[model samples]
Each structure stands twice: as structure tokens, then as C-alpha cells.
Target: MPLADWLDRRTGWRSLAARARADLSRPVPRHVNALFALGTVAGTFLAVQVATGVLLLFHYRASADAAHGSLEALLSEVPSGWFVRSLHAWGAHLFVATLLLHMARVFVYGGYKRPRELTWILGSVLLLLGLGFAFTGSVLPWDQRAYWATTVGTRMAEAAPLVGEELLRLVRGGEEVGEATLGRMFALHVAVLPLALLPVLGAHLWLVRRLGVSTLEDADVEERVGHARLCEGGEPFFPHHVLQEAFVANLALGLLFLLAILAPAGLGPRADPLETPPGVRPEWYFLPVYQLQKYMPRSLLGIEGNTLGFLASIPPVLLLLALPFLDRSPARAPSRRKGAMALGLLVLGLGGALGVLGYLSNRTVQAFGRTFVFDDRGFPERAAGPATEPR
Candidate 1:
């Protein structure tokens, strides 16, 4: 306590403390609900990822030859190493999921309408960075699923319009996915992506702080400005908002630990170059595109079908980025903006459907009283067997 007094007197930490207190004590809209705490939940997961990653780094071997073995050792011999890795694994999924839900809430509530366009954009970028973190981190396991997934995943980049080959080479560090590819992914998962994520995340939080909570997305220009100003009526963020954030964050962390303990991350057999296993699927989030690519005809007007499929995905991403400008209506209510709401539903529904199709691809199954054979492209054809009752 005496050292704290001396440091504060000499180094002026009290001034910084005052600023922090001022920021925390600022008035925010009273209507800010649990949905508002999604950002805080995401921030909590980011901290967990960093903490767990540092622990993994101490035991992880970057080379392809040793990476899988190192993980095996960490899981079996190291204390609670499996739990730490599983936490990181499952946390990545939850982190991206919360970001998506957060963005979706903003979209539905029209939080991106006015004066907060930059915040939405920054949040979108953070979501992209979060995906990069997942993709690269998944590859670090260097096991069968990771190996083939990376192999196909990197090759899928060759579907890009013009610089496809260059992109492939750049990511692979050569013509194929091997040790060099593993090294590059390790760098991205550990260092490059994290560095890029922090600044954008900081700016997004700063904008939210300065603008206060955009409570009434349905409010028009004047009411919107007033709420942003924290004028007339609102509640202080210190105890009220902070307490809500803590509660939601505790639930999120509890769920994360539960998932980690219940279903720890799995490491399959070592990657085999000679034998490419059947029924290999990419991560869940990438399933839509994976299914889309499968449905693509081998050649679409002489251009590769997968290339066309890859190009098709660009429009949706651009739409998300330009949503604020496109939906320029003054009213923020979902009912007031039918077209945007319908389009959002269509996108989400299509993505879910495609993910389902991707999961069922390359397999045969019975459903709806008929036995259907699903091709690698997920096309269902009638089988020879008799129909069965729907379960």
C-alpha cells in the first residue's frame, strides 16, 4: 500500500485512474440489455485464447514432424494440457459465434444505421480475423483432419479469379501444403492475425464508448442523437452495465469449460499422403462454401465451376460491408425495412441449408421413408432399398 502511494504520487497513476473512472461512470442508455453484453463476452474469449495460446506455445512444436507428437505429449503427459487445448479449440468456435450473433443483433436492431458505421465495419473485420484465427489454429494440429483439410483448403484458394495461383503459393510457401505451409499457419495463428485483430477491436470499443449505447435503433435522427449524447435519461455504466457484463461473461466461460471437459479436442492419426480418407469435411463455418463448391459444375462457360462459386461468395461479403449505405431509410425497425430483413433471412437460411448439405455430402442415408444415396456433391438419388418410416 505504501509502494502504491509512492508510485501514484511520483508517476501520476491517479490521473490514469481518474480517466478510467470517468469512462466507466459515463451514462449509457438504460435500455441496454443482455444482448449489449455480447461484445464483452467476445472480449472475454479473446483473453482466454491469448492465455491458453501462451501455454500451448510453451509445449507446441512448430515443425510438421513434431507438431502432432508434441500435442500428444501435451495431452497425455502435461498437466491439464488437453483441457487447455480444448478450451482454445472450443473457445475459437464460441468467439466467432458470439461475434456473428453480435453483428446479427446490430443488424436486426439497426445499430449500424447512423453515426456508428465505422464501428460496424471494424466489428466485421474483427469477425474475419477471428475466422483466420480458427482456420490457422485448426491447421496447427497437423493430424489427419487438419492435414487434409489444409491441403484441400489451401488448394481451394486456387479458385480465386486471377491471382489464385499466387495466393496458393503464398499460403503454401511452395507448391504444396507441407512443413512450410505448417510454419506459415503457425505464424498466422500465433502472431500475425492476433496483432491485426487488437487495433481494430480497440477502435470498435472506443467508438461504442464515445457514442454511448445506441439503445433505440427505431429512433429517428433527433432521438438517436439525444440517446447518443446520453442526455435527458439514462443510467451510469459502472455498476449497472458492468454487472450485467460480468454475469453474461460468467455464463459464457462456464459453457466454454463444460464443452472443453465434455468433449476435448481430438487428434486423429498422423497425416498420410498416400491415403486420403473419405468423408473429410472442413470446419462448420466453411461448410456453406464447401457445399457450394461441390454443387458447381466442372466447367461454367469454360471457367472452372469452383472458381465461379468462390466469386459468388464475394457479393455477400461486400453486401455486409455496404449495408449501412444501402439501407439508407430513416426508420430502424425491422418491419420498416422489409427488403433488408428478408435478404438477411435469406442469407442466413441459405447458409444453414448449405451447411446441412455439406455435412450429408459423400454419404448414403435414409430419410422421409426413402433410402437416398448422396453423392460427393450432395446430390440425392433414389437407392435400390425399400423406404422406411420417418423417425
Candidate 2:
């Protein structure tokens, strides 16, 4: 067979797949019409992160003593290295933001319903894994801030009840943060988690292909039919959609490069295992969880109440994982599901409130070993003191 003929046959098969997908009784929505774009945006960022991270690996040393210094050197000495680091940092934030928005869009549009349960479950797992990536990566800088923040974070895990101690040990690889801890985190951040995510992501995309895109149930079916009539018909996935994806991915990469060059991030002082920094806080993504730990009551059922707090995450996690099954109703539009809409609003409201409280709580400055008092107007006032003699 001629090479041209084989190429033509392969192209024909792909076109058939694209056409069949488009001609479904309800075609998978695209661009502004669905959450697919956000997922694509996230995937693009992930690719950026992986690429930049690999470059960083060339300069990074996994040892606790050298990791922080090596990163500093990369930012200061390695050519265009700062840009790479900044892009990785900012890209992580963008990836998480886009992913959350994508999930929210899916939930609101009823994409989790019926045959798409596995898709939703996989997305939830992806969300959690993204968080894990953020947490592990943050510690790699090994700065004073990162160290103390991780200390606070792992302490929260240690408050997790019966298995808390064991979990902490597993993560720390010992009684404390040391070489083993750094090595484990480096392995997880660069290799293990990403490897685990690939197959799941593939399955998620495959499911999306199989089940088709969920559409807005309230959209006028007749109007859609009329619009379809006026269209020039669908284009092939290869040249059209695939080209757009490549453009978007390139744009993301360019932005990352610009960030890495223009606003190269800096490392703070190296971690001192014996010292605790004041106002220690985890990465911004973790603020809500850390704040949740703070608000948990002192005790429950004769156990530390934070254990209950940790356990409370179970229901939400399960709900997120099982969303596809729970939302089995035929409704596919936000306006059609009042209960789900209300629940979504409630979750958003709670998250916003917790985030605000977390920021405010961390802003409370302590001085002289006493709780710093604030005035009624929310400003710190010097505790009433004797008038000082003129200096």
C-alpha cells in the first residue's frame, strides 16, 4: 500500500470518529457552551508545569541541606531560570483555579448525572491530586516559611485521630522533617503522583468521548435545531479543534515564560528545624483547610475534636466522588435543579467565608508573648501605657 493511501485511511477514520461524535442525538458541547474549555485550560497548565518542573529538576538537589540553596541559585544564576520557577508557581495556581471552576461548571450543568459518574469521580480525584501536588511542591523550596507552614500543616494531619500519628510518620518518613522527608516529597511531587494521574486522566477523557457532552436542559431544542441548520457544519478535530488546542497550549507556555522571566520568584531563608516562624501559614490553596482545623471544637466523643473535623471531610469527599451517581436526575441545566443549585451556592458561600476568616485569623499579630489586642475598629491599638518621658 502507498504511504499516502495509508495516511489517507487514518485521517478518514479520525474524521469518522469526529463526525459520529458531532452527530450524536446530543453532541458534546464545546468552547463557551460547556466546561470542556476549562478542562483543556487545566491540561495545558499541567503540561507547562511538567515541562518547567523537568527543567527545574536539572538544577534542583533533593538533599535538605542543598535544596533551598540550589533553588536560590537557579533563580539568581541559571539563565532565565526565575521565569521557569515563577511560571511553575503561578501555573499551579491557575491550574487549580481553572480546575475548580471546571468542576463547579460541571456540577451546575448536571454533567455528573447518569452515565458520567466515573467522569465526575475522576475529576474529583484530579482535584485532590492537584492539591497534593501543590502541597508537596511548596515544601521543596525548604525556606523558613515553607518549613514552618508545613510543620503547621503536618500538625493538622497529626490531629486526625487514631491513624493521624501513623499518617504523619509515613509522610515525614520519621519523627521529624529530615533528609528522608525531603526525598519522599521530591519523589511524590516529581514522579509518583503525576504517574498515578495519567491513566485516570486518560480514562476521564475517554469517558467524555463515550458519553458525549451534557447540554443545558432548558435550552430550546427547536432553536438548537434551527441554529444547526444555519451552520456550515462541523469541522474535523485534527485541523480545527486540535489546532486551537495547540495555540492555547503555546499561549500558556508563552505566558509562563514571561512570568518566569519578568517576576522570578525568590527563596526565603533556609529552614531552621528548631525555630518556629510567627504567623506561619501554608500555601493559599490550603488556607481554608487550615482555618477549618482552627475552628474545630476542642474535643468530641472523648477524642480531640479536630479528629472529628478531619473526619467531617469524609462526607464532602465522598459526596464529590459519588456526585455522578447522586445527581442521577435527568435535569441538565442549573435552573432545573433548585436543590443542587442551593447546595452549590451554600458550598461556595462557606468556602468564601472560610477563606476570608482564614486570612483574617492569620493576620492577628502576636507580640510580647501575649495575644495582641485589637480595637473595636479592627486596628491594633497600643495597650494603655504610662506616658513616656521625653527622650
Candidate 3:
């Protein structure tokens, strides 16, 4: 007689609802502590991104000719547009950060074992998709900073072995970034990547539901170390764990709001093909790879150094994706899994250090008839003046 009964009679909506409730109420692993709530926090930011992104679409012009103008008007004229834009911008940063933390947590706990291999792989793919979003979004603004940053990023793809030039052509829609490029990027950003990402996201969540939360005890960590340190069994996913996740999600949203208000996203000058910024770099997430490329020798064993550096970056990523296969040991404890722990720490620390170096690389100085630019990976060159304009 009721709406629920009507829907249930017509479309079996009640059964689907029952299934969802069952999934939500399933017991999570006891070892999943407060830190595990980060995945939920990241998920919350993703929802924010989608919501604000849709709002942005109403006013955004996906052409290089008008994209920058559209953005400027959005910030300056549209009602609450700045807030929506800022939320989308800042939400992206938080989404990527939270996902990185979540992945690190999973890695440290050895959660990517036999049955969970696909889960880890899906998460890794999602991280890559996040970067894809970053790449496509960077160009959408059509501002000087966005344009140059995209230029640097696309050029790096040219280091790929055989299909290098073709990859460049494919991404930029021609030889250079222009209207065609913007059109292609817009399609990818608004249509392609999101279409790909949502299905992958759905599958990842389904895998999580199917596999159940991995336990440190399953990996023999609790057995090696006394059982006192680990939780004996998990609480329900409903009230207890869901409440903690909700708290984390709310905190993340509140922080995002404050950041949007205090430090709103900025738009630089319009894109100019003739003018190149003195030192252009990719986003922070891509900086480690950029720094690595910069540090590599011009020629390596008679091969192009950029190519070698590009190749060098692949193995670590491959190893990350192939971790379940590489580390067959069942031990999950930090003390028990020394090799895995060291490797993980090395990768994490190196990435963090390189990111810091990249951020600090904007400094420039002149001494002894030579100009030194930290952004060029500490290279010194003889120049008429400083690399950047004088203040």
C-alpha cells in the first residue's frame, strides 16, 4: 500500500535495500583502527568533488578561447561560484592526499594478500585515475600556470620509448596545446575519465564488500607478537565503525571548507604559447617524478637520459602494483616483515623528500658571473640576468 511496498512490488527495491543493509552491517576486521577511516574520508571528498564539479559544468566553457574568461566570470560574477569552485579545487587535493594515506595504511598492514590482490590493484588504478583527473583539470582553467604546467607534463610523455611522439599527439590533440587540445581535455575531464573512474570505483567498493576487511591476525602478526596488542574480533560496520567514519568525513569536509574560504583557488594570466614561465612544474603529486627526471643525466649508457629516467620511474610503480606477487610472505607485522617495511619506507621517504625538494626548487640566485636556479635541479648556468623577473 505504501510507496516502499509499491516500489518493492514493481522493481524489487526492498531486496536491493536489504542487501545494502546487510553489506553495511557486516563485521569489519578488529585491526581496522581509527586510521582505517581515511578511506571513508577520501570517499567523502570524492562526493564533494563530483557535486561541485557538476555545478562548475553549468558555466564552464570548454574552449581555450573562452575557458579562462568563463572561469574569471565564475569567480567574479556568479553567485557563490567562488565557494563551489574553491570546494572542487581544494577537495581534489584532499582526495588525493587521503587516498595516498589510505594506500600507505593498507601497504603497512600487508592487506594486499592472496584474495585481496585485486582490491589493491583497483585502489592503485583509482590513484592513477585521480592523477588523470588532475592532468585534465589542470588544463581546463586555460590560465598561464595551468597551460605551462600541462605543457611540461605532456612533454614528459614524449620520453616514452616507441610511441612517445604519438602519445604527445594524442594527449595534446596536435603538435601543441591549443583549441583542439582543450576540446579533447574537456571531453576527457567531463566525460571519459569520469566514466572510466566511476565503474572502477564501483568495482573497488564491491571487492571490499566481498573480500571483507583484511586482518593483521590473518597474516600471522598477532601470533608472532602477543595477542594482547591486537583486537580479538571486529565490531559491527553499522553503528560503531560507521560512526567513526562519519566523524572523519565531517572533519575532512570542515577542513576543506575552511581552506576554501581562507585560501581560495587562483587564476593566473591567460595561456600564451609564445611566453614560457621561467620555471614551470607539474602539480605536487607529480613533482617526485619531475625531480627524478631533472636529476637524471643527459645521456645514460648512450640512451636519452629522459627516457631512462622515465623508464626508471616505471619499475617502482610496477613493483607497487605487483606487490602482492613480489612479497609472498604472510607476515604483516612491522617487526616481522623487515624487507617489505624497509622497501615501503624507502619508497615513501624518497617520494616525500623529492616532493619537498621540488617545492623548494623555485629559488634562484646569482653569484660569480653565474645564475643558479634551484628549480633546474640545482643547475648553474651563465645568463644575462636572473631566470625570473626581478621584483
Top candidate by lDDT: 1
Model 1, 50-125: lDDT tens digits are 9999999999999989999999999999999999999999999999899889999888888887777888888888
Clash count in backbone of candidate 3: 0
TM-score of 1: 0.93
C-alpha lDDT of all candidate models, in order: 0.87, 0.74, 0.85
Cα shift from native, residue 260, model 2 (Å): 3.9
Q: Tell me the tens digit of each residue's lDDT in model 3 across 1-391.
A: 6987888899998889888888777777776778988888989999999999999999999988899999999999999999999999999889899999999999988888756889999999999999889788888999998898988888888998888899999988899988988898889888999999988999999987776677776555534554334533567788789998898888889999999999999889999999998768888999998888878888977889889888988998898789999988877777888998999999999999888787767656665655665545634333546445456
Q: Tell me the spans in candidate 3 whose CA falls farther than 4 Å from its real position.
A: 220-233, 364-375, 378-391
Candidate 1 regions with alpha-carbon error over 4 angstroms: 217-225, 228-232, 366-372, 383-391
- Taking all chains together, each candidate's TM-score versus the true structure is 0.93, 0.81, 0.90
Cand. 3 TM to true fold: 0.90
Report clash pairs, candidate 2.
Answer: 28-213, 83-260, 83-261
lDDT of 3 at 369: 56
Better of 1 and 2 by TM-score: 1
